[model samples]
Target: MLENWKDKYIVFFDGECGVCNFWVQWVLERDKNDRFMFASLQSDFGQKFLNERGLESKVFNTLYLWKPGQYYYTKSRAVLQIANVLGGVYRLSAVGKLLPAFLSDQVYDLVSRNRMKLANQKCFLPDLEQKKKFIEV
Candidate 1:
């Protein structure tokens, strides 16, 4: 699973946040191209990623999209890139690119801060195939 992840886009998110988990499921549902892998921000692999990149490991509000040896995007950039990678109508997300990153991030932060209240803890049971997409779960 680890080796296979090297070729896919890795989405790192706040594992305990219902909203975060919801978004992960959203991506899973739309990923017809099998382009995404996921890791909870609390996982060891996620911690290592944060440490190596000099990011705060404990602050899980920030979402990270990593493409192994290629590149990584965070905050609004990550969200936009995920939509781009998902392709099709989601490509319209390009319009979001027009907003300044700072502005977009402010919106991300707002939602992140209130994410706990936005949704109750939701349990999503992934089927066998979907289970394989998780790293260090």
Candidate 2:
């Protein structure tokens, strides 16, 4: 099914972060249009993405949303973009755009800094269809 990922949005996440995994699960459950695919920041695909963009690969502090050969969004911007892509009620996330990127990223940084302490949530198991959405997991 990896072949099906062409032209889909890619979400890059911290493989070891429980919070990140939880959100990945959240996105997977809500991706009604099948518009997203995922890869852990530690994977070869992810490393190449990061290296090509001159981003740090060793530290998985930021989330990234990428449209292959197009552009990528990071931090709170990524979250907002994800919400926007999800559409429907999630479009409510549009209000978040009113806040400046600096402010939004500050919030993102706070959560990122303490993500390990904050997320007690366990990532639910993915069904086979959902499982294929991951790239080199």
Q: Report the number of the highest-TM-score candidate.
A: 1
Q: Per-residue lDDT tens digits of candidate 1, residues 2-83?
A: 7799999999999888898999999999999999999999999999999998999887989999999978999999999999
- Residue 69 displacement (Å), model 2: 1.8
lDDT of 2 by residue, 32-127 (tens): 999999999999999999999999989999999999878899999999999999999998998999999999999999999999999986766779
Residue 16 in candidate 2 has what lDDT? Answer: 88
Go through the candidates in order and give each one's C-alpha lDDT.
Answer: 0.93, 0.93
What TM-score would each prediction reach against the true structure? 0.97, 0.95
In candidate 2, the residue pairs with backbone N, CA or C atoms under 3 Å apart (3 or more residues apart, or in different chains) clash, namely none
TM-score of 2: 0.95
- How much RMSD separates candidate 2 from the native structure? 1.2
**What are the runs in model 1 whose C-alpha is more than 4 Å off?**
none
What is the model-wide C-alpha lDDT for candidate 1? Answer: 0.93
